[model samples]
Target: MSTIESRETSAISGDAGLSLIELIIYILLSSLLLSAMAVVLVNSWSTQKDVASVTQATNRGQVIGSAIERAMRNALDFDVDDATGTELRVRTSLGGNLACQAFLLKDGDARFTTSSGALPTLASDWARWENGIAQYASTPFFVENGDVVTYTFDIETDSAPVRFSGEAAARSTATGVSSPCW
Candidate 1:
């Protein structure tokens, strides 16, 4: 009976507290697991940011490119505004006699706005198609071959640049002078 009691007491004490080695091992393993999780979280965040940037650039490039193509395909008259081919104006079949649509690249951004019979005199009239364009990667220009017109644009992202190319034809030539919209 005495031996049995001593054994029971020893068993209870053995289960009461962890040895120092056991405690230290548990702490070390927990710290290692937590640090690994933190690293995974940081990597996931960086990948998400890059994906968002690329998506934004691609969406902007596609929307702007398609709009220009559509306008040219149904254009009543088309003209380039400047010698550098940076500005293009289209008088669409749907537009009023004194209205036009202007597309241009300025200050490293692709911009668009409506105009009266002539182009707007103030730069404030223009609005950006999207936010934050890399100036070095952008080259928005027009190339007209007879009735067919071609446009090209390069939209820059953090990873790679998106290139847009479109070609279309106008219904007729301009009835008046060059820079007809202006």
Candidate 2:
């Protein structure tokens, strides 16, 4: 073959294959990019999970708080455990004086019952009344008063242990009487 042709052939062959140095660089870059992507993905997943848990706990707290407030506003008489504030009893004016009691367990669950041992409806997903105890694992909610009757709700879930709290005030059904909603 002509020297030019031979040289051209060798050049083409050499260009077709990667050298060891080029291969090593390519591998290192691939590894670094993959590691970066993996870190980002892991962080994103953890944050999303935390947000979901917090959102769920917040929603549960709101529903439970609303239900309790409604029941209390209409209550003829009420009793709360002073020691723990984890239990509540209410005598309501609805119909023929409905007596209800709620017990909150430390496991982040709750149960409610009528006076005669009848199971009350589950107002939300966080609580279930089985046998006689309402169980849950989390922090507690407390009542606060202002111009309107205000209460705070706080809750936590297994995945996210941070407490979520909010204030809710009652809305007065009639004028002159202030409601908490404001």
Highest lDDT, which number? 1
lDDT of 2 by residue, 85-136 (tens): 5555555444432434443433445555444233243434224642212222
What candidate 2 gets wrong by more than 4 Å, as runs, is: 96-99, 103-109, 116-153, 158-182
Candidate 1 C-alpha lDDT tens digits along 136-180:
334447767777777776677777777667788876654544254
Clashing pairs in 1: none
Against the true structure, what is every candidate's RMSD? Answer: 3.2, 7.7
Whose TM-score is greatest here?
A: 1
Q: What's each prediction's TM-score?
A: 0.77, 0.64
